[model samples]
Target: MSKTQKPVDELSAEEAADELAALAAEIARHDRLYHGDDAPEISDADYDALRLRNAAIEVKFPELVREDSPSRVVGAAPSGTFGQVVHAKPMLSLDNVFSDEDVTDFVASVRRFLAFPADRELAFTAEPKIDGLSMSLRYEGGRLVTAATRGDGTTGENVTANIRTIDEIPQTLPADAPDIVEVRGEVYMRRDDFIALNERMAETGRTFANPRNFAAGSLRQKDPEMTRSRPLKFFAYAWGETSAPLAETQFEAVRRLGSWGFRVNDHMAICRSVEEMLARYRAIEAERASLPYDIDGVVYKVDRLDLQERLGFRSRSPRWATAHKFPAEKATTVLNAIEIQVGRTGALTPVARLEPVTVGGVVVTNATLHNEDYIKGIGQNGQPIREGRDIRVGDTVLVQRAGDVIPQILDIVPEKRPADAEPYVFPDKCPACGSHAVREEGEAVRRCTGGLICPAQAVERLRHFVSRNAFDIEGLGEKQIEFFFNNEDPSLRIRSPAEIFTLKARQADSLTKLENIDGFGATSVKKLFAAIDGRREVPVSRFLFALGIRHIGETNAKRIARHYLSFEALRRGASEAEIPQGKGDPGNSAWQELVGINGIGAIVAEAAVEFFAEAHNREALDALLKEVTPVDEEPVGDVSSPVAGKTVVFTGALERMSRDEAKAMAERLGAKVAGSVSKKTDLVVAGPGAGSKLKQATDLGIEVIDEDQWFERVSG
Candidate 1:
């Protein structure tokens, strides 16, 4: 169950009904976020819990099932570029029931809905819900005909060519099979395959957020060959359309599908009672972490075909079926201390340092407290809420990692609180610059005082912005960065990276000419302008890195920039994160999406979001963008380039460009660079300091070249 949600039995009918509406709306939003954008904010376990809560509520108040109940929805409507195809039969969704009571209620509801005798014998079958894209395969006359996705249940996208490439999917079924059959199942990438694909993507500076999205994006590629490159497998769990009756029982139909060479999950069984059904669900949940693919829940369906038909469906979900989900990842840990972090913008974010505990396969020693209010259990409206329970130091708190990589304190266990536990007092002063940390009305975060005196934070940022790993401006060395940063003359001082672009404009209004400045000359000034203009169009990844958000380093920044691809798209995602979500969740949806990236944790996501949240930060970025447009992130570099998959070394002074530039270029060509040359070094570019490395390369028979030769070959 969701941490924020009240138990179904505990809620009044009206409250339960309202909760159902909220849950339904929340699930739909998630569907669009995950299905439409391939960016899901919550984890599978978290999402399933929401659906489970919705089901439990509906079970308590069956009549309150909304028209938009998520139970009825199949996979998010396939809103893709592929041409559309309508399923012969709608790909109906199964209702979900989380607990034993919900399962018992489901069986009882089926009997009541069918008007069957209480004593009548009934059987049900359970199967794992593969966490993958749903594809409907249509075969005509024992030959492959068409393949489609479960788009909006009734409509689907045509992927016949792509599906044909999967060796697991048979082009032609057994000769004895029905003339027409639509094999419905999931198209998935195995766990090992997913890990390998991610590793390969990372080596090339590209990556996938998760396996399900990777499979969906891969299978839906415009070019079928692209889909063929992905290692995707399929499992036939159910059928959509058939020319002849396959069997009377659901188990028999699945067996017949297996007999025809269709892969079916081995962990399936017929359950005689709700207890047996619950046992199966527990068993699946236990084995879930080991499964190669993902399954959000275990789906149970009535075994008898006639009975299933009689039970039919209630609006969107079949009354004969319900999915029992696994519990989300949650654990109790000591709240060792609360550490306060002052970001670039001076926002004092409270971070929870906890006793090491594992949640969702990751050791979590740190979690976000979000704000001081969260520790005090203050509601968004400033009223006391969540039973007015404040999270105290030394409290045994519930830490949970939902679809988010960052763990959070769900609630405090008052009973387990330490005797010496004391209320945490949030600092009113900035911890970094010793300035006033003031909170504005209607804002949850506090900001540090800003001025010339406290420009320490901005100064550090300026240094990073011009570092070789960032924008790598040739003329903008540390001395220049510091000089211009504290320029004494207000007209020339740069407060942010964006102001760097406006230097020429700022200089134009000054009485002093840059060329006449003591250390600068006509030639030097021109060279400086050339360097600045040369980078007028900066790479998006470098641009993002130059901003210097907390926890976001070069690698993650590059990943984020490439993922968003454009400055405008990245800004929009940040802006959208502030909008209200389904249940007043501060939305943080875009933040959640950002966190979904493999290495992007909650802390990093929060930093990015906070950086964007500030009006000053946004203004500075906008000003910089007006002067210089950030280039779209480059695609994963040429893996087949000449230097691809080779190790190289640069052991001397580089005259053509900075060593950073050489490394970037070599990496772009898919080459591994090492500090020391050995037998593994395919080539060595030795310059002025050639000394030891030169002799070593000669002795090791490693290819040795000069700067001129190195540049000549790359250009060639």
Candidate 2:
């Protein structure tokens, strides 16, 4: 709300998306700094400000919030030193409410769900939200046993040794405590101690961005002595796993936590209404700056544990509780330049190169422009979008990241734009391979036309060849494909799919062995060779899919395989159909026959033909086939029968054959199975409870058969 850019309401969908990406990047950096390193660069207030802005933008753009926003997640990735720990119960994230209206809506939604009367009281426990790492300390038999960071909710890094050094966390709980308990809360450093720690770092020629990062980094040190040397405190505000109930209400649980010799937040209170809840938040905010440790906002939870259970959870966060986050920080910088990165699929992605600026404590260098249209500010209709504003190099742009973790360019200041700045021209050729890059009709992306020659496309195709649905080779994966493809020596490099099968023989006489590679061991190398050899004979459908031909997906490949029955037959047929010279009618040309198969459209047929038309592709196929054989597609039922190669649709409830069994049987008999009934459908097997499909079949005047008749037709 305080930035130089237009209000979230005034921005176009493209502009809003750009802003949201920036916020996400910025927020993620802060999370890593505070939770991962315990060294937050931004103050509690500044960080909170970014979060508040993020919520505002999200409120205006709900669909955009979902892209990269980590609003629900609480902690950063666990440090590498400690071994991992899986929690008995998942430590879920919490939803955030940034305004009083949001708070009011949250309460109202709860009451409406439970059908509670207006007079019914809904008490909530309101407490300061600590700016520190979330830890789950597991205690069994009233003794502190295991301590872990809330790493991605389900699992965390084991920090048991470092946790034992914290004075506030009792070494042992009361004898009357539950037999097993996992106390969940924040581990923070007091203001005085943080200042002292900073002073020590300065004297020792070491530096941390802020107290939060220092606290997080200090707490997760590999050396237990180093952890003990630092002054750290804990506030047990929640619990993860407990053998028995801690209390009936949330308020009572905090008190129970205190009675168990664990340090609990002293500022917690019971707020029976939304007004009371917001008042508590205000009270906390008033004294936030003076607090010994950082408090970004306040968390409010439904007091009654039963109501909390009834509210349950969404996919990721709790329904009965929400954190009231503050706002995010923002800054302005010059747009240095725009760079394009070629993805595996060959689409060039535009990235913003920005002068480094600090947003919520992270040094922001790059922000995603998303696409060429985003950089040029144009819509699909070639109309001016984003109010006709285009980003250019040497222009001053507003960079903002609302606690969303990513930084984005909000807007460019026209007055600050360089007088001689030139418009960015998106390259029409592949930056990597120098091939013609063209975008097809009805598609937004421009891809490099050089699929076979392009190194980027080649690597991706190799990956697809060995993917699970394709070859499914055990040990040969993307890394191996990359390593083998990118080998510096000319003869050793794997240039095509055929080379993968010839690796063992090629390396047999060479001084260097695959087993001698860094990642490969004797057992792995043997397994890799065995896996490659095992795939010598494979299903035709899998082999076709493994070719990595454009637009020929799994279903299309299966349909094509069923149509041709064998690799040689398919290759000859595809090679003969040189161009788009076919009709989608049965008993036509080979191209027409391919197009006639259900789900195999002209586009897919053309792609297959195009692949075969190339002499190099034909050569590659010949070389690969010499080493391996694709088993002819075996008839599912009887390919020579009347119903063979027919497109059959089974609708409604079948009395004899189950839906899956019927489909499988149809495929076994060499029938092309389809889910829906249409003009292309040759036969419709209608059973009882047959609805629209049956009527449509009858209306189309297509042959309609019953379960018994269908079996008879197949058997006869």
Candidate 3:
């Protein structure tokens, strides 16, 4: 065979493999600094060049790719606070090319390959790449169906229940629409919302490092209510599978999406040629910092749908799309303190609390300290850490964020620290609980032995139980619930979350007396009671989740409930189990058996076993059961019926049907109407202004049904 050009043979197989791993590690380090950390050593153009070079090298040596490579990964792992979801389609990273030369080369490559005439201009659509979580939304028969993260391409975690809470995502579609439509977009926390969220976190002694992380963490929450509480907005940028084409060109498709009430990216430009595309890219680069939200880059896509298909894709990214990233933001800030935080799993993270500093217009206050090893390398002694010395307390440090989300601490400044400063001291006991804390083998955290009694654990766990994912008690926010529970010690101890349910019966007079307290009016008190009353009958999945078993998230809870069928059965089964398993239930086999069921992991199973073993937890559960009931499994809806057995999510504004009315109608028709869409979604009823759920539906290839058609079919 004649070779057009010999591939670079500078490195042999072993050498190339080693270098590839090193490159991936280096890039991932930089990615943490850029995307997660918000600090970059390189300029926008330089970073783009580096990424491009990496991509080129990887492209040439495809076998060197690692499963965890930054180039192959789309978003960071989901935060521990929310339930995780895998996406149906892998959220692929975009390829970026900088400078006019790069754009011209790209155009040349497309033209030469497609055999287009030089005079024939390639109409390219340009839009701002919103620096937020990329999501897919599905709509069937004009009603919203499901929303999901762009996971590993074939499957993703179901986030449909949570996505429904975003008001910006329309719950229904216009009077007329396609049978199936999927819309793809970004879910972003606005600048103001991000600031407010951080402020709230600060007041509660919690922290939100940046807006992008906050947005991603919020959007992925198991509780739709929590996602809705954050000021999350969606801007439709692309489409997934469609029964019929919405428009011919990318510009027209975006316009139609807007017309159909989708929040299309407002900052978009039409470029007629590669030169124009370059100009637009540069213009966006210049104006990146000035935009209301963060944007790491500008994106260019093939205008024609057929052309995009023809161009096809590589193993990781699409051939049709590319992102032109701006420079990474970099700045210096004083390392005020290094504080350790315990996550739900008891991972102790060292955070470099910094003096407020701005990079790329956004102010940053904290950066990741990594771990004890990183801390020691940075120097623990009073001596100031130079770049060579790593970092030390009271030293000035460099910071960066990529796409303006994560915050990373760079080198330390020795010149700024006082001569008498001492090395930072690691704490031996839990800061919140003051319990005898010990760092377990193979773990980074020094955990308190307080268990359920720890104030922080008790408060946080209580919050989680009533969170949007659990009992979903409305009117009881994090602060309000904490205020009530935290104060119980002086008067009485609230040992369990089920105590909240029994309060109405045991403390009806006290509850009335609460209205007379400062800042507590009768209206507010009534609202709280009403909210509590509304949630007396929660779904089995939610009830299981509300127990606050470690690692037993919404997905696991659902699976466990489905397997056992009833709480009595589950409790009996767990009691009969001989060994400890999932979630570590302190070496209890019964706990292991619970998690061994489908969708239940060892982490969750152990937690359930541990919780049931605790006398306090069992007592609390009994109290809760007295006040509330779990949602029972409904009989299967008739498959012959149009809406039967299908999970339907609603989005956007609906003129003909109120959302509640539609949900009621769906129930009346024996349809299993759901708040969010997942892999199980049968149809999505979309409306004008339908948001990410529309994209999720189309991507899954589930039917998208519109309201008018829905009315017609169901009514008939």
Candidate 4:
């Protein structure tokens, strides 16, 4: 564990919940950039770390899991540039393991779940985990019908025309193949091809970042002829939505795919034991660089189809398969300077500028410093890092791409440090707005207090409001947000969310028209207006999240929206809720009610109350609400469910399912899952060791039932 992160065992439930919310939002944003846009901001290692942290927290506090948790979501939603194709079978992602011990545990978990004796041999197929775009080719009656890119697991972009251009993907399957089969494979560009392509495009000044990105860009091209011009290959490894059984085992199925005119990796092998699995992984790693395409790691899957069926899957990944990722690559570089970048949340993040160096085939010029403490060789728990040797300008620092993607400084070479190098000083004020930057207790990051006044923060917040996960206005993105924020004409400028909805009206009244702008043409300006008008009514959850309240992300926003059912109700609740006076203060009824919702805590309640209480925030919110209507979220699952819209609580041990699972089930039945029993609780599900909550429920005259009875009532 990094010193900056608190141990999972040590984190309080409230802290865990807050961190989970933040991680979900951060990961979602990265998913949009990486999966939807094919432009990643962080390296693979950094992304994995965030996910691993989330998993650890979820393991320690399972009941705190939110509906929008990263563990439950796959790739981002389709970008809407192509026709949408809903997968017949969901295209789930694989859970990742970074260490040998984790791999061993994974196998042990499979045996434990299957109740298999230790002496019995279990076979698994180990293959190279490709680093490329996942494409699903659907065949019907031995003819190719559609090819789609995995988009959020359930839906994908229809790239059938583009896919047909690749010779490696067969236009028709062999007669022996299933009548309907979705052959899942990876579309990749060979390293040499990628290099040549870059060289060819150098004259145009538009080169790709990596082979994986190049393959994705080529496959997503709107014109099929353009895709045909690119050098792309496919390797089939799995199947989805098969009309008939293809084979009895994993290896056999892959062989059948190869016989049916799909490229199957020759390096794939069957491993019957843990030792064999590890040996195969090592062998694959040794030959990874020599391969024509990139392989990030080795994927191991249960070979037997029966065993795979029994193991089934988790919410987002297979229970019988996992990806064992390769270790990060490191290099040494000179640190020239440290720069501060302010985020929409006012976080003052430090970035280290380094002399250009190559690590893992990618050019490295910058790395994340994390925070002031990290730069000063101080850990979050006040421990020493790198023997308490602080980093300085001109120091030769060891850097690595975390997950072969994100560049990060590991430590400095003391002998290479310049004699005149001085201890770096962290700024106490915002670099953009000159406002005080203060670090709060128990927090590692220092934040700017400038709020909306800071240009960087304002622009970032505006961008986030129009982000894919929020309001998601089609014509409004980061570049457009920045352009409008700094526009010279007052009528054309958009510094706040309210101004966006009023852009057309403002432009109509002004002497200058948007069409006359440098980048905006008549057709583009009309489309922008239509896009803005399309978002006049948004879901209450998205509306709440767009406000960007501290400690409130998409999951927490949804929780609040579900609890209150409307923006007006949530605002009223926040206004009536009183902040606790001290450590032991119980606070007012409204506060108690807000905190009573499962996955919600005092931290979130306080933040929501604080945001609503601020005079400027209220003024801006009132203005924005005038232009947009926030609609209540439709009830999930069966609207006629007996527990629909009812507040339900669970007490004691649940034998049939885990606490988190029970909560999820109840939620699916359109019931509100509460952490504590109160007058507002409509039902209570009690089990073995039922205690205080059950008594409280009885005293409140709420309906109480045993776990089995509760399940019986909700079962469809």
Candidate 5:
């Protein structure tokens, strides 16, 4: 490890292979801790040093590139809780370069790929690489239908409901576009908001390790409102599956995306050459400290769309793009104070509000203090003080913020600590709820035991229930929900999920008071009522899931709805045997078992059982039912058409029904409509946007039906 070796005469083949293997394993372990657990054991400086060393090794010995090498990966595997979603196109990692020679080599490679002259000018787009999850937002006929997390390049979890809660994300794009398009972006927490959020989380006695972890956890939450309240921002960087052409160059594409209502990263450049690109990268690195949020690096893309297409992709990354990361940001500040904050869902977090100091050109006043174990350097052991320990008041702290975004304390200088300073202790009671906060067995988090009765818990829970991803009652958006609850008389507090139903009848004399609520307005109030009215009938799946039962999720709700078509049927059919039991109280095991059916796991079953068994929950359910009817699932044979229960596909120039119309028809007839063909695809619908799916269906010898054939089959 002490030997200094050059690229060409570095080491023997065996030595290189051994070192490469060692580096890959080390990086993967750190990646898991950082990305997966939010408990990184290394500083950004140290992590980059490791990454840079590994990349250099790979550059020297390309043969050492294993399939699982971190050098070739963009992100780690998706966290366990969220459902999986696949990308239409793989989300690939970008190549990296730190020096002028590397930039020149990249240009040379691009020129070779495009058969262009060295002197010929080429366009390029450069933007900050925000530190957050990569996601895809898909629109059908200009309306956002789904948003998905970029899971393993091939598949990802669907987060349509949570994405809808992001006010920055457009619900509808302009009508001039294609029938379908996928917009790609990063979801991040604003530095200021991240501080506020952690403060709230701490008060609730649930400590989040960092903003990125909190952001990811919030976005992947089964409940959409949980994501909504977290102040997440999105920056569009790429596009996928456009019906029409986007732009001539990558720069234009970003511009067009911004024009179409997507928030593009404000810091970007259109470089004409490698020199200009390098200069742009340097400029960004210099100002990184001034940015409001965290960015890991700067990204550079080959400008022309045609050139990009020609460069295509190599295994996991595109040859047309590379990330030019700055030599990470580091700073020092005095730890002013550590405080706890509660979240809308009652998660408590620890916040470190530091004495204002400039870091990487940005003013740094706050950093994440993490949890009690984290503060004590117990969670990650003796890893760097930056990745562990909670810096306390009067301690001299080293802070690091990459790209001026995510500010974190690197270490504590013991010499600066007051002699009387002691290890901080987390409170046993929720500051907001005054409830005994308990850290359940096997869980690191300490949550308020007040449940929904606690003031903070009550407000947060109600907010969660009315969120866009849950009941999605139109008039009851986040602002309205806040307005309705916050303005309620203290004596007549909106204490339960059932209480939301009584809002219309409650006394509110003026719109002024209502409008004065944190996020409400006149038109918004009207929209809220209309949305609430529109939700008089909701799908049984959504209705049940909206109850915010601890473990039951969207998928579980669907299974429960399919198993029992009506509320009465579910209530009567669920038995003790169906409940999934584990250690602890096991809640309502019998009721859990009844809804627990095949797909419902032990966790979900227990939550369902517990919810149904609770008398208060049952009364809330009754109240909800009075206002909204839950639609029963369509019976197996309800579609009386000839094509009923038959899988159908439409393909090649539709003469009759629009593809969406055709799919809807097939669904109505109880047939599953598929996007692509496999051994399982029954009928292939391939009218335009019909790319590889049509060919696959034909190759598989599956029935290939044109638009007319699709209409004829559905009509039959």
Candidate 6:
């Protein structure tokens, strides 16, 4: 169950910390799938909701903000397929505003930050927020030197060759342009072009999910010829790393880029007041469909360059600008049926099979039902949703493509429901393995108890083991894993992660060689073996995550791995740890140590202990361990630092930096920052309005210091 169901203010410090850690890991995974892989699982609305919730929690419990918070991250780390380019100026993202009130609050905050009088008119430049790949073109001495994609803000993938193929991008700027200017904009495909490209690719049994995906895929092509064939265009809206200022205002700067032969949006306007900005937003949103290319929203930026500089930036986005996203497009569709899909963790999720409908220009056939309660018209708080109208199989439902991505059922039309339609009876047994599917108290979904015996769970676990953040074996993709898992040949089939290591050996003794297979050539088989061999030695954190343990995501896995340092140590600790029966009950020394490791909560600790306690799990783990050696994490920061390996807690409002920033700084200085003060705490950083944590530190006789003193000691 998600911790976000409860109000942020109502959450305890421990609950807030756990939610923050989960959000960080979840957001990071989505970012990687969207930016790095060009495949996004959730809608932009869903993604935004997660970020908004994280922000809300952080606001309520400032000291509980984690080092890996989503606010501190921008885009995904660059895939190593292309040469990396570190930007001269970081390519930051823009914060989002969903409603008129949010926009008003943003403007009010900006005015407050600048100490500007309410009487004076503030100007903002509003433009269509194009949905495409962000690209940076660097020019030197009137010639385009390089082009790069926005890869994690700090560093980007060098796509100069593919970028040169786009006709809209200027090969050379005028002599009046700066000696070194990095023009930044979106590389997009027109709706007509996207449709035509899809039609062409359809004949070859391959098509892109959307125009944005097509544009991204086209731009990242290793072959320039392949990219040249695609109908891609560019629009200059911003600049990065300018040797000299382009203009005094944001609108003029974009206009200046247009003068240098770059295409600029014709709908760009300057709004003098909040009302005018809202009007502009409505006008743009109304004509969004008629636009040649796709745009998800309208971006509003501070008109004056001086004010923008004064406003500065947040951790990942600029403070002077925000994107007011368009509402989710809605459509009516027939609910054909509901199917249960068992995930890696064995949670049986109900998916709504809808009659095909178009929403936000994308074909929608499936929507998430969330769980049994959602279908039964129950909200997270046990309140009625859609006026307590439950959904039925033959009902006419209103479907919405939230944030122009994943479609979800909003409500059902009671009048249109078929007379024969019956209430969905959520299964009590696992559909795959016939094991009792149990819905534990406080959890929203029913989970299969079949565990390793369930084929669905086993396959999903195998997929997770070889996922990008896990072992990441090069030739072992999802399709290949599925193929090998169900292969008819005994020697070729791989039911577990340990079996993957035995494939080459098994194939060597088999009568039918792997190379003789339809899709496999001798060269391909050799490369696959080499790729599989490459992953024999993986980082311990990734190895633990690959195990697909509940509550143990990438962040928690790293925390556990770093604490244990080795797989044997972790296994021993988890095996010896005792699970507590109630709140505030310390189980054992191992359990206490696990729970006391800063961000590692009791839930995660219990999950680890439970997994280790299972004999089947331990046996499978031992078998896999024989085939792979998990490497320990190298020590980070200076080992000689005074706070190295010491647990420190911060209380109240920090003066110099945010709680996240402070925690990151402490980690860099080799200190482990804990959320609460305890006997294990080595030091405490106390700010104004210091609460129970401060008193606890004093009671424990732990050293306490102010923000300035912290800087002083860390600086040395």
Find the candidate with the highest TM-score and give its number: 4
The number of the candidate with the highest lDDT is 4
Cα distance off (Å), candidate 3, residue 65: 19
Report every candidate's CA lDDT: 0.76, 0.78, 0.67, 0.87, 0.69, 0.85
Count the clashes in each prediction: 2, 35, 85, 4, 42, 0
Better of 1 and 4 by lDDT: 4
lDDT of 2 by residue, 15-111 (tens): 8888778888898888776666655555555666677678778888888875457675556666665677998988887777778998999899889
Off by over 4 Å in 4: 1-126, 129-250, 253-328
Estimate, for each residue in 1-716, the C-alpha lDDT of model 5 and write its tens digit. 33464453467778878777887899888876765555566766687777777777778888877777776675667666555667777777677676778788988888988888978888888888887778899888999987887765667766777888798999999876668889998988777777666544454345454566677777876545356657888899898788888778888888888988889987888899888888888888776656777777789898889888988997768989988766656767788778876655456666798889887666888786656666776553434444454556788888876324557666788777888777777889999869887777655556777776677766766766776656776565555455556654642345666556555555264343444455666777666557667777777777777776665555556656755667667665553434434565433534433432434555566566666777876787778777777888654333677666454545555545434445445655766544334464566766756766677777879877566656676566
Kindly list the per-residue Cα lDDT of model 1 for residues 1-716, writing each as its tens digit: 54776767899988987887778779888888777666565566677777767777888888887877886677677674766789998887666666788888888988788777777878999998787888899999998888898878889887887787799998888987899999999998887777666533431223455677788888877545457668899999888789998899999999999998889999989998878888899888878767777777899999999888787766666778878866677999999999877644566778899999988667999876777786898855687755789988899988876322436787888899889899999999877778898887777877677632456557656776777767877888867877788777765677677777777777889886778778788898788878877778878888888887755666667657755778888878766765444564634546554654434555567778878888877877778888878888754556777776566688788886556457657767766555555555788899897788789889989898888988787766
lDDT (Cα) of model 4: 0.87
Writing each residue's lDDT as its tens digit, candidate 3 over 128-198 gives: 88877677888888888877666444444456666777877887878656777778888887776787566
As for lDDT, the candidate ahead, 1 or 2, is 2
Task: Check candidate 1 and list the clashing pairs.
Answer: 42-403, 43-403
TM-score of each: 0.48, 0.50, 0.58, 0.62, 0.58, 0.61
lDDT-better candidate, 2 vs 4: 4
lDDT per residue as tens, model 6, 457-551: 99989988998778998888878888898998988999999999989999999998889888888999999999899999998899998998987
- Can you give the lDDT of residue 210 in candidate 6? 68
Q: Please give the lDDT score for candidate 2.
A: 0.78
Q: What would the TM-score be for candidate 6 when compared with the true structure?
A: 0.61
The alpha-carbon deviation from the true structure for residue 107 of candidate 4, after best TM-score superposition, in angstroms, is 23
